[model samples]
Target: MGFFTDCSRALLTILSLTPASNRHFSQHPLALQDITIEPEKASPGFKCQYPSLKGWTNCNGPNSRDCWLKDSASAQPLFSQYDIHTDYESVFPQGIHREYWLNVTDKVISPDGYLKTEGKVVNGSYPGPLIEACWGDDITIHVTNYLKTNGSTIHWHGLRQLHTNEADGVNGVTQCPIAFGDTFDYKFKALQYGHSWYHSHYSLQYPDGVAGPLLIHGPSSANWDEDWTPILISDWSHRSAFQDFYVELGNSTSGVLGREPTMQSIVLNGTGSYTCDPSTDKNCLPQNKRKPIFSKVFQQGKRYLLRLINASTESAFVFTIDNHVLEVISTDLVPIHPFKTESIHIGIGQRYSVIVEAKPSAPVQKDGNYWIRTVVSDGCGTINQSKPEIGVIRYNAGSTALPTSTNHTGLSTLCADEPPENLVPVVPWPVDHQAVNDVLNDTFEAFVSNNVTHGALRWDLTDTPLWLNFSNPTILNLGNTTWNPEYAIIQESYDRGYVYIVITTQAIRKDPSKNTHSVAAHPIHLHGHDFVILAQSNQTYDVSATPKTFNFNNPPRRDVALLPAGNTGGYLAIGFKPDNPGVWLLHCHIAWHASSGLAMQILERQSEILPTIPSLDPTRKTCKGWDKWLAGHVLDQDDSGV
Candidate 1:
């Protein structure tokens, strides 16, 4: 497990990697105020409150105050559904396009126990509006450009985007973003089902709340009765969350490009901790009718499934209902053998569905109050904070006990109990998806060397040239070690004109920069699919044994990794068939780093190669060329310069 306690320092140290590579960015500068979204709702427990959570900060990386950190919002109608038409687009003009807006104000809601978005949705809905359709249903979204920027596209989070390559909505590599104000209609036949999301494929606009959920409810596979819930978790900061780090190192190093944040909080289903509830000052929301209230009633011994979605932009957490254990059944969008555990650690973009059982015979906890516990932590899985968000799993307040009421904990454990003869089918599934069969794969690793002499130097992911050995980064000037135990980002670069996502500080931060002496462990996420952690030199990664195991068949999938500073760096083997074609984004999931410059793009399968140009009519550009040639021969007047 790699640990990065001081994200700012780490980034500063790492910036020594190649400050010159990012020199070009100094030009074509974009202002912080120009960032599209402002602060409103940051995250679950970290509420700044309206009047106090004001300002426009830069989007450096996660954990940085530059986030325009969320101030917290409590509006009843979190998300409202609305019909919208948009065109699928792709943009890759080297900063050639104008700007646009996603207006996080569009809001939408998922059925079951979900926290609503106060604003930031197109119509004010979290996950935006649901695009409802059937397996074979064809849906078209006509995207209307509203920003001054030209290049942009919308990537369907979980959609195949297989045959509809152009509709893949990737910028640059797939298709050019529609011209500012131009409209592109995205048409696709609904294939699979289940919980999914959508977001801009152009810039950091996503963290600004430019993303939304896409749910496709298909035929129920398992004949279970109850409904499902999505536990979406994300890191939010209203102001520049990493600015403090940036201020320290200044020009000497890459400096912490991320914004520094003031406070960090965890939210439950999008709401603040029910821990105290409507009690603490403004922290406790006022008693209102809009608060979402959901209940789960089941027969004793009967089975119910709780589909959990760890949608947090950052943070790897454990979800539990105190008394009840969660059975691991499915992950991401794939099904696994039903395995039960007391608690499950969920990382961003990971999903799990467990069946909860209310023991008909077990005595119910006297009252309806039940603890919904979630633990946020450091990479090694340390319990950074054990937050208990409370909820009720009891009978109606005054209603008399009916003939039979199942256990108070409406959920069930995955072990010991065998799911019924049939289990709930994984929703919106592929015709015949086979992730375990893909054969072709690859892996690599390296170390970083530092320049402690001047408190600076360049580093790389390989021994090739810029790598580093964090444990012994090197000796620098005045005994002022460039390799502090604190700096989270060991290196950062904008080398090829593209932002290469580095540490997702806001995604996970420990103490204040400068004051803290611990290095940072950024949680970086890639867009398309999971990647396998191969190997790490220095302390950059963690490994189990000499020779790591390989999943010739199937490997665990994840979007982020916590980089360490020494020899025993962690390594994981992840593989996903590059069946879906288009430009796929492979960068750090951290919002702040992604914003500052810790991001990059991967050009996947080439677009459909076409034959030589088909003939054009006489009035076409080709014909005009012939006309010009003839005129050049017929005129003189300084060679017909006019």
Candidate 2:
């Protein structure tokens, strides 16, 4: 943790985000103030009907639901209320069972002593409810917004909604927000099977603690005799300028996400110690002691499916359960070949499922006793803020707690003991004079085209000319912005060194001719890859008009570098070797923009046996009316047929 310290404060872009800051929370409509929500036991789902807009319905039960606005309101506005029941289920949430709600008020505290709150919340729980399902299950959820003035839309992060496009709730793109005093249904089948998550899609509620774990269990036919538990980790902070996160991330020895910002504390299975002292969180004390219900236990020689979700609005941590070797199976709703590792790297809004086999016996019989230790570090493999907390994997707790020993420890026998790589590329060095000079006289150009940022990535999605556009054209030529004409402008800002080959400028910089300037630089940090920094100029990077060669060797492998604010474009080359499967986040380091819609997930293709998301029940066809409309839009794809 001490190592995260050397950075130029002036150029440090704020990359750390929390659940409450207005930037991520976005303001929830216009309510006078947040009215407190007092928890009371009530039948789970809403029983009454509310008027529907855009033909939206509330058929979705507590399990799954969609919502829309009610003519957008304002006032001392009497807010509505919803109730939910949570239990100690397994990592996998059963079919049609989840909690969702609009968090009216209350603040979220961070390990670094920051408190954050505001906005609608799913399942009424921070990090939301842990959803578990087997392959091929019909998941239905109905959400009711009790907030006075806000509206929101929730999205199942990483779930493939095959023919379900509207259900692919991405605000302003898929559908509209679930307005105040209204409810909608979110019905979909779990098609692919792997660890996934859910969060508000319409507004900034996503980063505002409105996300949770979604785990899909593998087919029962697989080999293994063990139980699984989901450990969802979040770096929470309300709105403390003192703990503004960016300071911890940038100033730390590691650049941005590359370093372990000082988290208030790492949460295990949603709870830590009872003393409320995160710094001295000792998870070993028995339930009789404090935070008793938070205990995690496992028998030796058994494979425990660990569903790991990085729910942090910012910091990512490397979780390591002492003395246990984890056989990682999947990440972000997809799987890599089964690989063993001492710990797994969990990034913000990412998930990893691994099977950890407990050792039957201690490795060394010291004083006829042994201690099991669990620890974690920065998920990006940079700097760590906290020391590893140790806990014993107690065998036969009540009975003769024989001095633990690894006499027959089966960890090495049950799984490969090799560790998994962090996979995020470590920058070799900052760009020095030699590296910069290498690109002084080289350039190349390619054809450029445009593609719609559709909700469904690989299907019936389209714009017009399907050909790939490679040239860096004026922002307006990209079709990214459909913005109002009054605010748009043009300028020729400059970045001393950098270039951006923007793919969607037509939608952003809407005007091509007037020497327009309303452009923002995206400090896109490459994961597991490094690119060469080229020259930067005003306007944009015109590959067709300028030079185009890249330098990969001896390149700066930094974790974070700005693309220079106001520059229309910049260029660099990311090197990916396909070491890990599953999608990784590529977007503006700015948390607000990133939360809004400025992000893309790139799947690192691999041949390893990967996990699939649980499929939705074939029997359920939404409602009778909604069925025909959806069937008409069902996408068809395949090489042999359509």
Candidate 3:
């Protein structure tokens, strides 16, 4: 069968298998057993009753401002007999299809009142246009690269690309980069729901500006009066990331070690204020010519849902609003039990869905303006001209005054995630302890080494630092028995059982130079699955004792988590079922670290992948185009090629 034909067949099968009675939840609206079947839905199907503001019998539907479709108070399933506990890996609603077209090009832009000569953006905007969809919707995105010299690919951050590995979009691991002027169509099912981002996976591309917000609307654990667009908070650099990479790599000729690039300012949803002296810098815009301050209007007593994403090149932030309490609803793509906090520590590539009640502290100003702060976490990274108060929240819609509210006191500056105990998943997933011994026996040590990749300093999560060939991705060579060592492949053949992997910053290997020790936290992200955090600790991993500390009982589960920084010991242990049969990239979300080889590929059930994929013609065609473009071009592959 042809590729699209297979996808169509799968969708049809899903529709046919769904009991007609359950389509509208005609009976047993909250009963989980009523939806039982030999096999569950995995593909697109006929348009079913999606969550909407109108016509839902029991409660407000998914699109309602006051409540999410099947909220905690409704007692109704999220969609057609499915609730929070339903195994999302196997079942999803038969949602409609969503299509989008993005044109990537080079342009001169000023996101922070300073012009960037080498900016790359999608559809001519930084933090590109929002891509929204309903849960279980089949999405098709056509990305055409118009860069004068570079190839590009967009990775759907935090989306579990189940059964659709080809659409995962890691340039060298999934498919070759989309050659200049060539369009690559990415097709995948919305297996998981929540807000995330889509960014260029090609080296240094996303940092330049090729990224945008992606929202897959679904059920929520908390109710809100309004839903806001995703707030993308990032550390910005005046220079293009490509040029800054040279400083990060350092001068090998002079024996100077590479240093982390310093960011100039913080941008919230693509706008920030930078102090520039026009006398010294002609690229800096005058105060009158600069963009206005980023602000959001809030009504008194109304609760609002806010989606926050950290898309920084190398910084973690503490998100907060002065004088207002935050109710965190979800972490990453997983809905969690609501918890109240003064501030949230967010790592790179991490996302949070929080609800903020519009009640200000006593003696509210007549203008009622509050500051939205994205404070860079100390020790995690640094910014040259750091500004925590990058935005404003106004209770009065017409208020143009700056906030006079004082920041909440006692906010920690520690560079770490919210305590693991606080991030309780609403849907409990009890991890099996059978693999405890296996995980302890094969723990992956993450450390920095200067010996790898021609003496350039590199970070390694495995024995070897990852290096990729753009012309040869792992998907194209799935049938091979032994893979290239530089690919950093970890094979897992289990199709039904859970696979637990422990990653630590403590150096396990003996380094004669003693330069392998690094006290930097890494935001480790795994594609294709939302893994359970079995254990996260700042202490050294004791093989025999640490196993006892594992939280097998429904620990915090997400796509990304911070591996704490420590010179001697700090570790993050995660477990996931290897049910998906494809190659998935697991790497640090830090742009510089990833390019420096802190990455690896997981070949899960490789033997089962080729037989499922009907054709590689689409993959081959893009590679051919890339090869053709490269024949006449002289672009050097300097970084890890993503």
Best by lDDT: 3
Cα lDDT over the full model 2: 0.36
Judge candidate 1 at residue 458 and give its lDDT.
19
TM-score of each: 0.52, 0.46, 0.89
lDDT of 3 at 410: 90
Give me the overall lDDT of model 3.
Answer: 0.80
- Over the stretch 1-642, how does candidate 3's per-residue lDDT look in tens digits? 001223533564565333222332111122322211110111234222343213323233433322323323333234323445545565555455567899999999888999999999999999998887766666889999999889999999989876678889998899998898899988777767779999999998998999999987666777776778787999999898988887777776665668899989999999999998877999999888888999989888888888999999999999999888899989999989889999999999999999999998766766789899988998877798888999999877888898887788999978898998899988778688877236754577776665636557677777678889898889999979998888999988886667989888875443526446777888999998899998887788777798788898889999999988765689998899887788999999889989988899999989877754546778888899999999999977667777
Clashes of 1: 160
Q: After TM-score superposition, what is the CA distance of residue 259 in candidate 2 from its true location, in Å?
A: 13
Misplaced by over 4 Å in model 1 are 1-119, 145-153, 170-182, 189-191, 218-223, 229-231, 238-263, 273-285, 289-302, 360-363, 379-386, 390-392, 397-548, 557-567, 596-600, 607-642
lDDT of each structure? 0.35, 0.36, 0.80
Query: How many clashes (backbone N, Cα, C below 3 Å) per candidate?
Result: 160, 82, 1
Give stretches of model 3 more than 4 Å off.
1-58, 61-80, 509-515
State each model's C-alpha RMSD to the native. 20.8, 21.2, 7.0
- What is candidate 2's lDDT per residue for 1-642, written digit by digit as tens? 001112411111121111111112111232223221111111243112221122222222212211111112412111111101110010111122333333322234332222333423555555566665533344566655444333455667666443343355443333344445455566555544556667665334555555666665432111344544455665443343223423422322321121223334444444442224434543223334433223345565655666676655444455665445767655454434456666654545556667666563235343322333223331222212332342334444443243343322222321111122322112122332332222222221111112222211111101211111111111112232332221111111221333232332222332233222223333343332223333333245554454443343333222233333323443333322222222233444334334322344333332210222122221122222223332444322110000
Ten contiguous residues minimizing lDDT sum, candidate 3? 33-42
Residue 158 local lDDT, model 1 = 55
In the range 1-642, model 1's lDDT, one tens digit per residue, is 011224422442343222221312111234433323222222223211112112422221222211121212323111110001000111000111112224323333322222323223333544444444322234567665444322235666656543454455544334444444455555443444445566665443454345555544332223234444444554432322223223222343553222223224454444443323444333334435234433345454545666665544445565665456565655544444456655665555555666665542244555534445555543322212333342335434553332232323533321111222222222221221223321111222322223221232212122122211111211111123233222222221111211212221111121222221223334444544434333222233222242233323223333344443322233323334443333344433434333333333333333321111111121132223323443444321110000
